[model samples]
Target: GARHGINMNGKLQRLQEQEERIFSSSCENLVEQIIEKKKKKKRKTIETDE
Candidate 1:
């Protein structure tokens, strides 16, 4: 039972780490997309003004 509990704990920790990594990457991707969108809008506005 002790060995089983240790194994389960290890697996749980690994799963938690994987989830955190995935969540962070998705957030980074979302932020990058938003930045790109803002840059594009700014460029378009500048071109229109000129």
Candidate 2:
């Protein structure tokens, strides 16, 4: 019973790590998009002020 429990724990840990990696990569793309949107907004405001 202890051996089976350890095996399940390892599998769960690996799955968690994989999910984290996927989330982090997707998060980077989201951050980049947000930055781009902010830059665009700033440019528009500058143009309007001019």
Candidate 3:
């Protein structure tokens, strides 16, 4: 029974780790997207002024 419990706990830990990795990657992608949007807007404004 102890071994079974340990196995279950390990499985839960792996799932939690995977979820954290996924969440961080999603956050990074969102940040990159926002940065890209700002850059594009700045480029558009510069071109219009020229």
Candidate 4:
């Protein structure tokens, strides 16, 4: 029983790590998208000014 408990804990830990990695990668993608959008907006404003 103790061994089983240990195994379960390890599995849970691994799953948590995986989730954290996915969450961080998705956050980075969101940041990149926002930056791209800002750049596009700046270009539009510059073009209009000219």
Candidate 2 residue-wise lDDT, 1-50, digit = tens: 99999999999999999999999999999999999999999999999999
lDDT of each: 1.00, 1.00, 1.00, 1.00
lDDT of 2 at 22: 99
User: Which candidate leads in TM-score?
Assistant: 3
- Winner on TM-score (1 vs 4): 1
Predicted structure 3, TM vs. truth: 0.98
Tens digit per residue, CA lDDT, model 1, 1-50:
99999999999999999999999999999999999999999999999999
What value does the lDDT take at residue 33 in candidate 1? 100
Expressed as tens digits, the lDDT of each residue in 1-50 for candidate 4 is 99999999999999999999999999999999999999999999999999
Q: Per model, how many backbone clashes are there?
A: 0, 0, 0, 0
Query: What is the alpha-carbon RMSD of candidate 4 to the true structure?
Result: 0.6
Deviation (Å) of 19 in candidate 4? 0.5
**TM-score of every candidate relative to the true structure:** 0.97, 0.67, 0.98, 0.93
- Colliding residue pairs in candidate 4: none
User: What is the overall TM-score of model 2 with all chains considered together?
Assistant: 0.67
Write the candidate numbers in order of decreasing TM-score: 3, 1, 4, 2
